[model samples]
Target: MAIGRAKIKSVGAAQSPLLGAAMFTPAVLYILLLVAGPFFLAIFYAFSDARIGNTEMHYVGLENFRSILKSPSFRIAIRNSFIFTICSQIVVIVGANILAIALEKTFRGRGFIRFLILLPWVAPIALGAIGWKWILDSIYSVISWVLVALHFYKPFNAPMWLGEPHLAIASVLLVHSWRLMPFSTVILLAGRTAIPKDIPEAAAVDGAGFWRTQFQIIIPMMRPILSVAVLFGLIFTFTDMTVVYILTAGGPFDSTQTLPSLAFAMGIQGSDLAAGAAISLFLVPLLIIIAYFMLRVAHRAEVN
Candidate 1:
């Protein structure tokens, strides 16, 4: 047995660098061709005066960022993006955690219920957001009709969900939260189920109440899983413009504009490639910082 184990270890240790490189070459090429390639292009464009359909790019240091800083639209985009991400995640994490716990226990129709929960994540974002657009529309909205039928408001006074500033933000936030919850619940559910039944059973024997077991024992163990889910959710909400675009198009009067939407408008619609690239790149530093700390926390949890 010892000799066999030694042979296995030696075989693994004998893996050549060239063989390793050959095995990993595809992934390296893929990243370079897809991810790193576009990123470097964006950086290059950010420092130059470039525009759509213009081959000529003049060297302009910080000019694009300077213009973006001076734009009120950019300022609003920054505020809205942060508010949207933070608010949606706060609601999603708590709601998803509860749903995950509920779904963990066996029950009738559970398989069907889980399928329903997974629908949004499986559905394309554009399709889901477009469906939401119709739902939020003033003329043909099912929600508005339902509320009116319930005597919540007269037809003329029904809330214009996509028209008012605060209402528009809230509406989009709800859509994002709904779309994100399924993924969060699935991940958290996995985390919850990974805990040995013996641990919770022992806690129960120790007279731990439901709340005590959840808060003290279960939550502490689920920290790493929660961190991963939150990080992904944060990045998704922060970078997503499809919901805002389809629902409100950053209206009424750009009140719902997020950084991604704003960048698209400036870069594609407004035809200022440099400014758009600069606006989008603003997220890089912030996302990097967030990913670093979250990963550190995850590593610490893993160690414990």
Candidate 2:
């Protein structure tokens, strides 16, 4: 009896790894079908001359790519997209960090403060942009009215916030950051909370000032979470189009066009499905690079 029981126990232990693998197999297969499958299809469509109206798809080699590279509008859209993405991420990351830190501290009405800050993030981006559009209108902007009242500018002197190139870019960046900051802030706040208070206290007891403790101890400890926040922020900001689409539609003469918006214009709106697919596929390479580096960093972070 004892020998038979031992054999059964050993067999169960041996099957555990296989069972775990089998459990995850469904999720792995789901991801492959849902993500990898569409990705390859998009790549094929991007490279080929696949049109909506045409029944035949002839591979034109690099002509589509060449057109994307040479077209002045495409170049401008790419540049603007980069600018908007970078600027928005900067604002979101910095502002989120500050807000997260502030909210992490015990204070009066901290809960209320957090709720208010999170409202913008919870709101729909398209609706928010539309509301902001009205507020930023050349003739009806409340900001313009305030400026006029304060003698900062006359009734008709308000700058064209969405109708001008530089101003439009700034406006879109501001809108995107405002909408995204709250979400990032919440994420960072969760990260900050995971940090042990003893770490900072120990640093402080060792003759480290508040600033030093924050930089050398607190920030270091929070690196993993911050990395996560940054990664999320980057991915969201990189692919965002709703706010830009509703607010400016790459307006002010396509000054605020990002890759997603440009892709929509070229693919869906312009009925050039192949070009849109190509532009959409452009995001994959960047995502792959980012994912590689982020995973490497995350792994190191875990080991540390």
Q: Pick the candidate with the highest lDDT.
A: 1
TM-score of 2: 0.85
What are the lDDT figures for the candidates, one per model? Answer: 0.92, 0.84
Tell me the tens digit of each residue's lDDT in model 1 across 104-211.
999999999999999999999999999999998888889999999999989878999999999999999999999999999999999999999998999999999999
Runs off by more than 4 Å, candidate 1: 1-19, 297-304
lDDT for residue 133 in candidate 2, whole number 0-100: 95
RMSD of each: 2.5, 3.9
lDDT of 1 at 27: 99
Q: Which of the numbered candidates is closest to the native, going by highest TM-score?
A: 1
How many residue pairs collide in each prediction? 0, 0
**42-158, model 2: which lDDT tens digit per residue?**
788887888778888888777778888887777877887678777888888888878987898899999899999988878877888999999888889898889999999877998
